[model samples]
Target: MDRLFRSRRSTVYSTKGIVSSTQPLANAAGTKILEKGGNAVDACIAVAAALAVTEPASTGIGGDCFALYYSAKEKKVFGLNGTGRSASKMSIDWLKKNHPQHIMPNLRFKSESVFKVTVPGAVAGWCDALGKWGSGKVTLADCLQPSIELSENGFPLSQCSADIWQGEVERLLQMNEKDENLKLFLPSEDWSAPKTGDVIINKPFAETLKKIAKGGKDGFYSGEIARSIVKELNKRGHPMTTQDFSNHTSTFVEPICYSFLDHKLWEIPPNGSGIVALLTLGLIDSLNRNGTIELKSMKHNSVEYLHLIIECLKISFRDSDQAVSDYEYFKKKFEADFHSDAEQLLSSKKYFDSRSSLFHPDHAITNKEMKEGVPNDMFKSDTVYFTATDSEGNACSFINSVYHGFGSCIIVPEHGFALHNRGGNFNLNPKSNNCLEGNKRPYHTIIPGMITTESTTNPAADEEELYATYGIMGGYNQPQAHVQVYLNMILFGMDPQEALDASRISLFAHPEHKKLSDRGEGSDGPSSNDITCVGVEDDLDPDVVEGH
Candidate 1:
């Protein structure tokens, strides 16, 4: 009986290498790459490629990408900020004049956010990163093969994917559901009851892959693919200019690394909410003078610790609310040169009431009056993430997304792609960042972190010497998740997989993201209180479903 019920699958054991991702296809992609002698960076790209095909709802070629790669040879870590920029042709005043909300204040969005739209930057990003870091054995096609096989032939329909699919059925089927793209991806007569194990295929996606592989990344940006996306946007009244894709470029930037509890943390700058994460850790470090914040202990989990950290969160986030913006704004606005002031602020205990508001940053700017300029790097999209490690001591934590999954679902008929709805991150009825300003990077929700510390010989000694490369994926949840999980790993000492398997709850889900996918709700049904953490403010109940 045990043999009969036992699953017939190979075990994924690895003391030498490990790959973890939201989708199994992505995991396999990385696994294959590692087996072929590809480095950590190469394995990361392979996984990303697989994710683009299998988790289309959460990620794709049209999304933004951020990664932290540790180089074994150089003994250094590099960061990649593959976020897309706003159309260079756009302007803040133009957005004020065009005030998208004026046209569709209550947009009947069938997708994540109509305002969530942004330029697609992932394909170029993937290509660029892989080019710089790939090994001889690695190739785009190698990473994509399994996904292509699954898409063109078939793979099991994940229970989660099926339930999520059904939830979006009405909206997805709005355009006759007969569209070849939709049909090629979903179950049909042959897949009536998509239970735990059912074959689902996406041949169109496979065709898309072929085009991408043959033409290189540019094919997706300039050829038939580009047209499809542009046409779809033009038809929907979006202003994504042809010149937009023509001018698109993804950059490689220095990764931001911070030292904490004998370990270093890493993140991307400005455009990502990563700075906020750093701020939170910095603030906590300031508060925890004893350098010990624990959990699972009755005293540590008490209201006192939670309360102190909550206050710390408020101060740290205020810094995020004020200074974290596009590169132009960060340079022009929060000109204090953070590092110089960070230590002083920590020593003086000077975070609250000394506050940083929009007004504060404005005053801090050297050229206070010369504000009318271009926004070259405002983050504008949703995101996804993954992590991988090679025995060679190289590790990578990556987060990428199409702003919102399928990004606006505003399909470009010609290219068969959708744009991001990142414009939605801005505020209304007030002067705000992340607005529908042209060229502004949107407020991003993906932060990939690496915890590096020397492995200590004394497990019974102090709280030092545990190295880990980990990441969390929900938008606003990204930063908070980073902080919380970092604590969970250090203070609570949970293993990486166990930490990920655990629930991630935010007092508030990012400003607009829904509580995961409806399918994220378990079939076992609602937990007692869909909500958790009384002091926080998400509308979900304590037990219905866990979020992250």
Candidate 2:
């Protein structure tokens, strides 16, 4: 597959700096910052803000963000969790009493539900990142200026963003009638989605960005923006308060790592679902070490290889779903009950071996047979992921998102941005680790990935050097893509572009037929025979598909 696969773009190289993203305009914004002598973090924040304006359907300031930064000077990695907590006054008991109709297994709140909106955390994350890792040559206002200009002066909608926006037209139109801010997105005379090449001017959103630039974090969290958020949520019968907005804070955490191919893969632990990628890699590594499978000997995307990868991913997801949640909750539960923390437990080779022992080379494991591994208990989200590397050797892997397209579809007219429905992921069962609770973050999906290797010159000193900053943006596709892209480069020796462009497989529950037993209409409840499907790209070998 490596020899047969080709990339549309060549591997990009730069001695000064490089920034990569989905939108050209956003990329330009980051490069502009880099040209202005800003470091990778500064460029990343610029790119993130520009994406909010250029790719509104996928990301915005009214969302959440996470970042992993590799410091060239310190020779280490740092993680920031910028996800918001649920409203302090809301909980499972309150939700059940007020909205009993929504109670169900694996329930996701409707996109338009006010109760689904959590405090927006992206602004704080951006501000905090700049304060901690910025080059000090640029200010918050400087990083955001490009986005403000694009919003106020207008920019042509890119073809990809236009297509995504058009697909969400129905969802946007179905928003609450009082959400007049929807007009900012429906700029057409007929109130339809804007087409490609259309110049979209968002003066209101520009003004909001200006405020944030001028006042830093407080500009969004405690000023008129916060008041507006609270008022809009309150009018919709949500229990959100201004204090909830003010209390939002991003957490700094040490990254968790797994060794593979003589390098370390770093991920922002648990709550971000990066553990799934680590566990999947660990399982494969364990299998290879124990002579259960020989990955290099098998053809990429062959029936045997695809089946093995899919099975490992399924096992990882099952364990994550049972265990991943708010980091605070995870620490409390694991420390008091299990006498260990998430990073220590999830990264253990013993646990990985215990889970990998379940894999059978010839037999596919059914959902019923895959249970959470005893050593642990664990954690979709739409998002934008981009990476930047500076001349100084620092790298930043950043991801930002507003969950589903158009987020909650509950636009704030004055702010010209939509609230995110991250609260929708909260479990209703109080016994679950991810159960809905006040002032607690729900399971998060956005994660930034970093790679590092031991310093060659100072191996005895334990010094490290940055290898790469990378991520793939999609809900559940993230971890799966991370694993595939990493292996494409390490095992197959593909360049960066080929690694990303290579055909991949994803394992997920079938949306329409969630359970095999309840395949008919009105079958929305969980059942014993849930079906997990393997999705592959069209370019995959036909024989491999048939064999699988």
Candidate 3:
């Protein structure tokens, strides 16, 4: 077979079950659950809870989660939106009156700010998914035991996790000296971040996990844990109440899809940014169908191919920013104004054609031109993504995250976890679809992806067999990576391992369009005129880089 990228690792074939994650401990925990006769959903929950303990820098119970589960028995995919909502008191008017500094253009709410904390929904998501799809063999308590043990007995930190933890030391120290995080995370006399291979014990977190294990969702949502989160936020001048925590619930929605290469790519609907992946794939499909760009004919990672993909991604980002938002908000607004819903309008062939027409085959579109083309609108986001498939053929594509590194930089001392800063993604512009509102979810970034064989007779039918469950963790790199990895396997005939190992590109929003102050500004970086800045991995050929 012709191949542009060589695999560094072979794909493991499993007959019983498979669990893949960034940390060995987390993966082991999931595998243990599967070995005990748990289904994919149970294994995924086991992995997620274990990741919260083992990789605290990227994810925890204080964050949010999203998942796509393929139930082999039913032959259908289900989506779970575990994202949290902004505080009931949060609003543009409230921010203008209470914290005007956050409303300034190009100024982002600090990661450590109390206003950035959202109602964490991972625990609720885990409970809901378990109730809906978990194997009867494993109880919630059973699924959480591995993490509880790891947290209480202490687990050696992996090198990559150690690096991420160390990077956040300063940010942690910048919090109040009396803060409990100093005592828990920085156990050293010098208050330093733990080094690689150091055994770290999180007794407090273990206790918190115990609450969830015993009481299930209520264990975390209504008891001491809820009170602690509310007390901390209230003490910090935020208007979070225990009721807000109690009111939190996960939503089960239909997974959206885009047909390409005789298969269907599935993702969680709005609120999560999975729509961006579908939109990006739709544009490329349009280009391929119309003979504008023959993706299969181009050399993998060639300058021409990279440029086309980058340009297509820019368009997708622009459109998603305007279109993607909390499902209820998006549905209401679009239904009233456009007489259409997000899934139908955004995924329609007409929308793809209109967006794809702006793609120039030879040159990049200017930032101004991109802004003009879209009707609307619109993070090294630290996240963990892993996939599991059980012997029963059930598969779960799961993702969990804190919006940024050490989310909100505010640790709940009693709980031993940081509160996620998901509210940081909300727009201050009231007219925007993603504008902050009381008890409203922000436009979430972390998304889990699944793909299945398409029904040739009816491409849009929900009746399809599971092909794979996969995801890549990062901020905006997710959707771009999703499209790239999917195409690598489907269009280029690369194996699963090679599809993942292959070189890829990432696209960032134009600096001028971003509300965040840090856009990596430099003389050689993205300029005001550029539509979107493209970053290529070093593994790609230098000649391809120069040609672009």
Writing each residue's lDDT as its tens digit, candidate 3 over 1-548 gives 22244556888898998999998899999999999999989999999999999898899999999999998877789999998888888887888898786654543454466787889999999999999999889999999999999999999988878888888889888864655666788878888889989999999999999889999989998999999989988887898889999989899988888888988889887777777788788888888888889877898888888888888877767666565677665444444432135556555777678878888878887655565234432210799999999999999999999867778778896778888888877766665666678888887779899999954455575577888899999888888899999989998888889899999998775555554432211111122234567887768889988898
Consecutive 10-residue window with the lowest summed lDDT within model 2? 519-528
Per-residue lDDT of 311 in model 2: 83
Best by lDDT: 2
Candidates 2 and 3, the one with greater lDDT: 2
Model 2 steric clash pairs: 320-379, 322-378, 323-377, 323-378, 324-378, 324-379
* N/CA/C clash count, model 3: 0
How many Å off is the CA of 48 in candidate 1? 1.4
Give candidate 1's whole-model lDDT.
Answer: 0.58
| Tens digit of per-residue lDDT, candidate 2, span 503-533 | 8987656666542342221112121126777
lDDT of 2: 0.81
What TM-score would you give candidate 2 relative to the actual structure?
Answer: 0.94
- Write down the TM-score of every candidate: 0.76, 0.94, 0.92
